[model samples]
Target: MPAVFILLRSLVIRLLSSRLAGSVAQFLRRTISTGAAHIGTALRHVWERIRSQESKEAVLGCVLCILNMHKKVET
Candidate 1:
């Protein structure tokens, strides 16, 4: 029946929209946490290197190298 079909379609759309919203929320949360972890790691590494008397130039070079590598991978 037309009424039954319409009801089914509406239910399906609602279900799918809810699922998509959930997926997007999960992706955003994961992205934010991953970014935070990376920043924390970089800060810790820099602090440790500085404390260990590593050369500033060498640390800067390493950081630049990492950024370049990330850029390449992203592309």
Candidate 2:
């Protein structure tokens, strides 16, 4: 019947939309976690260098390198 077909179609659409949304959310979570890890590692490295008597210029260079790497990743 037409009514049955319409009901089935709507159900399929709802299922597909929900699945798509879940996939997108998972992807975003992964991206956020990876970016956070990169930032943490960069900061830790910089901090260690500073504590070990590295020059200010050297620390600045390290920060710039990390930022450049991030720019490359974004593209």
**Model 2: per-residue Cα lDDT over 6-59, one tens digit each:** 999999999999999999999999999999999889877767766545576687
Q: What C-alpha lDDT, on a 0 to 100 scale, does residue 44 get in candidate 1?
A: 80
lDDT of 1 by residue, 1-75 (tens): 999999999999999999999999999999999998999798788767585445776777776788788554545
- CA lDDT scores, all candidates in order: 0.85, 0.85
Model 2: lDDT to the true structure = 0.85
Runs in model 2 deviating more than 4 A are 52-75
Cα distance off (Å), candidate 1, residue 59? 16
lDDT score for residue 11 of model 2: 100
Candidate 1 accuracy as lDDT: 0.85
Candidate achieving the largest TM-score:
2
Model 1 poorest ten-residue lDDT run: 48-57
- Model 2: lowest-lDDT 10 consecutive positions: 48-57
